[model samples]
Target: MSNEKITIAKRIAKELKDGDVVNLGIGLPTLVANYLPDDVDIVIHSENGILGVDAAPDKSLVDKDLVNAGGSHVSTKHGACFFDSSISFGIIRGGHVDVAVLGALQVDKNGNLASHKVPGKMIPGMGGAMDLATGAKRIIIATLHTNNGSPKILNELTLPVTAINVVKTIVTEKAVIEVTPEGLLLKEIAADTTVEEVQSLTEAPLIVSPDLKSFDVAA
Candidate 1:
């Protein structure tokens, strides 16, 4: 991973709290596990029926049968248990998860998320994103500020939305934004980016917080 992306993962990890049950989405969000605070105890939840999910194991310790919702190799923490999707979704829909860290294709000003599919592309479908977004106590999106030079954070989402008004915060390589009733709030700016640069790259208008944080890359 590039330093910018790794820095994004490290930033998101700080959002996790002790005793929290965090459900990590596929792709970039998966890296959050590697940077979690060592002093706290947090259980990782995988939709594929694994609880207490551990970081990716070293190749020597890889277990073919063990994996996360994304089908990537993973290890299990002590006391970890496995179950069927029924019980898994039940835990999600029953609101047992404290936070759902997701990656998004697009996030609009209103916090609508569109991550699962893109119009004509053949996708496995939305997976558990809909359930996690709706049921988790909090939702945080970890993604690049833009995609191939185009902004992913927008005033209006152009792709099919996975869920509406569910995202709580957006952690991008450039900034940290909070989704609120008023609008998308710029809570923090990247250490190397300026407010003008962030605004220029975003399609949505940002409400700069009075106590906005800067140099988040080192925080």
Candidate 2:
């Protein structure tokens, strides 16, 4: 792959608008902060306790108490504020976040997302994902086109759902798919990927834009 995680993150950062309050989920979601438009006043929120958080920190300056929910040390820009978990979740539940970018294990055709435990594997339970998905003005899922080369989008999710009909768009290495009442719409495809390649990985039928242009994620 082409360091797909970085490709997905860079594209997502470009989609953000100015002055948006964004909450980034643990892993890939956190990478968005590093690529956001420096000119835009985008404020990042972490579910654990930090709001207006900064990007990844230098390992030498790690602060145990300034970690995100994923246990990764986080820095902060000037004017960043700290609050309790209860307050952070309240912002999510109260719909204060403009966008929430989350990493998902699976996303169904109906825009339902499954990010928690699997039947055979134990993992961290859903913490603020449910709240962020349901309450954010926009929910963006960042994940690979596949897991171990197997599709992650399914006809029906095998795991418990975090939010139903809440995902607005999915950003993957190969394409950017929008969730609509009809089906997944192929909004854009990476420069190196073909429509056929995207179709091969999509569990549902994909709709191609008549004016679709080649996607250079870095462009």
Best-fitting candidate, measured by lDDT? Answer: 1
The lDDT of each candidate is: 0.91, 0.86
Q: Compute the lDDT of residue 5 as modeled in candidate 1.
A: 79
Q: Candidate 1 residues 1-219, lDDT tens each?
A: 877778889999989999899998987888888898889788999999998998789999999899888888989889999999999999998999999999999999999999888878847698899999989989999999999879999999999989999999999989999999999999999889999999999999999999989856555
lDDT of 1 at 48: 94
Query: Candidate 2: what lDDT?
Result: 0.86
Q: After superposing candidate 2 on the true structure, give the runs of residues whose Cα lies further than 4 Å from its correct spot.
A: 56-64
lDDT of model 2 at residue 20? 94
lDDT for each residue of candidate 2 in 60-163, tens digit (9 for 90 to 100): 88887887777877788899999998898888888889999998989988999998778668667677778888899899999999998889988788888888
With candidate 2 superimposed using the best TM-score fit, by how many Å does residue 127's alpha carbon deviate from the native? 1.8
TM-score of each: 0.95, 0.92
